[model samples]
Target: MEFLQQNWHWATLAAVTGGWLLIDTVRAKADKTLLSAVEATMLINREDAVVIDVREQAEFAQGHIPNARHIPFSELESRKNELEKLRGLPLILCCASGARSGNAIATLKKAGFEKLFNLRGGIFEWEKAGQPLSRGSKNKDKEKGKKK
Candidate 1:
């Protein structure tokens, strides 16, 4: 008590630092669930993971992963049934960056999606990682499908 009163600023600093450390420890567990581009690719290759793009239809139409299911965030709740076929598979959620996909993961979890992941840095990172993308022909096919 005497030392604390003499150095109250030090005591306050110590308390604040301690609190931050505790919170960071808890957050580490939640954030550890994140996957790098390479790890995500390996999971897709070996585990036959399914990619779910949570971007808007226009964004998806612009470009997206081959075989990735297009389910906009607004429609995810109503379209949960559509993902039933992918229940057991590793669901990789992606967006322009990762923010939308992160939110999508939580939304799906609440809707009882047990297997899911947010693409770390999303398609932006995938391109940066030098992964392949569909060419003109395949891109045309997906665009035509969305028109109907």
Candidate 2:
């Protein structure tokens, strides 16, 4: 009690932060906003979820989820209008490790998109799960640039 009295501010801050984290977690769970690779595949197959690759062009050109629309995260806001047509469908955002796409969900939410989901563990998990990626144009171009 004495120690807490002297450190009450620290305790209050800790409690507040913990509460915020708890609520955020609960809300994410309630909304079913996060999707594992398998879940994402299921969503795609059953609901026709549109996968959005937010990695930069070079990264995306290396490989990407099949049929995923490429929209770098930095340009998501400006190019959001392109996604307006997909607004009513489930949009799954992904990146190399899922961090950028997870952060990007907020951008879509602000743009009035309701069915937004982040790919859990991103493309890494997708590959780990043995999901196939459509090799993009860069590989072919690189090969063409090399001459025997």
Candidate 3:
């Protein structure tokens, strides 16, 4: 007791750490699965994954993965047939953040796409990780035309 009294601060720290670990353990099962950029790269390469940008048409035109298929969330239901060619392949979904991509996943899953993935933090993380962004003024030109 004398030793513990002398090291009350250490005792408090230990107790807090243990409590945090306990909470983490309990929360682990409830955690959402997230794919980091590295894991996403592997999945793309190994599985020949098809990346789908589910942002708005303007957002997608601004930028997207080089070979990604642009299927804006608003148009997914109507454009479902366009993605038929990619069925059975792993599909990675992305948006500005992750909300739209998450929704895209639900839509695709319901549409019977067996393999689906949500880019953990979306294009934001992809850019932050210094991944290559697609080039070509072609898409941008179309976007500008729409504004006028």
Candidate 4:
């Protein structure tokens, strides 16, 4: 009790942080929009969900989940009309580390997109899980050189 009195600020900060974490966890779970790589794969296979890579062209060109459509995050708002044709499909949004795609969710939802989902941890996590990546011509060229 005496030590806590001296460190009241620390205790308060800890408590607030713990509460924030708890709330975040609950919110994430309740939203159910964050999907693991494997789950995202299954969703694609079973439901034909559209995978949209929100990374910049350079990052996406390095490597991206197979069949992911490249739509840089910076242009998401402006290019939203392009997505309207795909509105009915379940859209799986991804980025380098999921943060950008996580944000894309609200943008899409506001556009009346009902089936938006975020790839939990994004392409980095997908690559970490040993999932296959489809690279642009640059990587293809490197692979071709290795073949020769």
Candidate 5:
């Protein structure tokens, strides 16, 4: 007890850090806002949720979740109208990582999109989870060819 009393400042810092962590954990749990790759897949397959990839065109062409619509983060506000038809459906936003998608969520939320979700850890996590990604601009060409 003598050692703790002498290092009271250190003890206080540790306590504060631990308390902050506990609060953050509880807050995160209380808000089921971010969806994991598996949960995203379930939403896509079962609920027909609309997946919007917020990465840039080059990044998107490299690969993306199958059927995900491309809308770069920079253009989200301007291109938002294109998604109006899908407003009622769950809109899942994704980027290279979670940060950009989280920002996209705020943008969509301000536009009154209530069923918005951020892809937790974004495409990185999806690939890490072994989810398949649709690759290349050629795939789009192939899809168009099928329609003709």
Candidate 6:
């Protein structure tokens, strides 16, 4: 009790941090829309969900989920009309990591994308899970090299 009194500031900080972590965990769990790579794949295959890669062109060219439509985060607002056809289907958003897609989710939700999901760990997690990536531009580069 005396030690805690002496280290009250430290104790307070630890308690606050723990509380924040608990809240974050609970919030994440409550959000049933966040999908793991495997879950996203199942949705894609079974429900015909549309995968939208919110990463920039360069990041996307490196590799992305197969058949993912590239609409850089910056252009999502203006180019959202391009995705009107997919509004009724489940829309899975992804980026290099998960941050960009999280932001994209906000934009999409505002646009009435109800059946939306953010890839929990993005393409990095998908690759880590040994899921295949479609290297669109890279394959072109390789083919060009062969021609030369």
lDDT of 1 at 11: 95
| RMSD to the hidden true structure, all candidates | 6.0, 5.8, 5.4, 3.9, 3.3, 3.5
Ranking by TM-score: 5, 6, 4, 2, 1, 3
TM-score of 2: 0.73
Q: Candidate 3: what lDDT?
A: 0.82
TM-score for every candidate vs. truth?
0.71, 0.73, 0.71, 0.76, 0.80, 0.78
Candidate 5, which segments miss by more than 4 Å at Cα? 1-24, 138-148
Question: Which digits, one per residue and each the tens of the lDDT, describe model 2 over residues 1-148?
Answer: 9999999999999999999999988886776778988999999999999999999998898888988888999999999999999989999999999899987899999889999999988899999999998786655656876963
Looking at model 4, residue 24 earns an lDDT score of 87
Point to the candidate with the largest lDDT.
6
lDDT of 5 by residue, 81-106 (tens): 99999998999999998899999999
lDDT against true structure, model 6: 0.92
Best by TM-score: 5
Write the residue-wise lDDT of candidate 1 on 1-148 in tens digits. 9999999999999999999999977774577546667878888999999888898877887778777888898898999899988899999999989999999999889988887888888888887988765433445786888999
| lDDT of every predicted structure (CA atoms) | 0.84, 0.90, 0.82, 0.90, 0.91, 0.92
User: How big is the positional error of residue 46 in model 6, measured in Å on the Cα after superposition?
Assistant: 1.3
**Superposed model 1: Cα runs more than 4 Å off:** 1-30, 135-139, 142-148
Q: Which of candidates 2 and 3 reaches a greater TM-score? A: 2
Q: Write the per-residue lDDT of candidate 6 for residues 18-115, one digit (tens) a residue.
A: 99999989998999889999999999999999999999888999899988888999999999999999899999999988999999999999988899
lDDT of 3 by residue, 76-110 (tens): 99998898888988888899898888888888889
In model 2, which runs have C-alpha deviations exceeding 4 angstroms? 1-31, 138-148
On a 0 to 1 TM-score scale, where does candidate 6 land against the true structure? 0.78
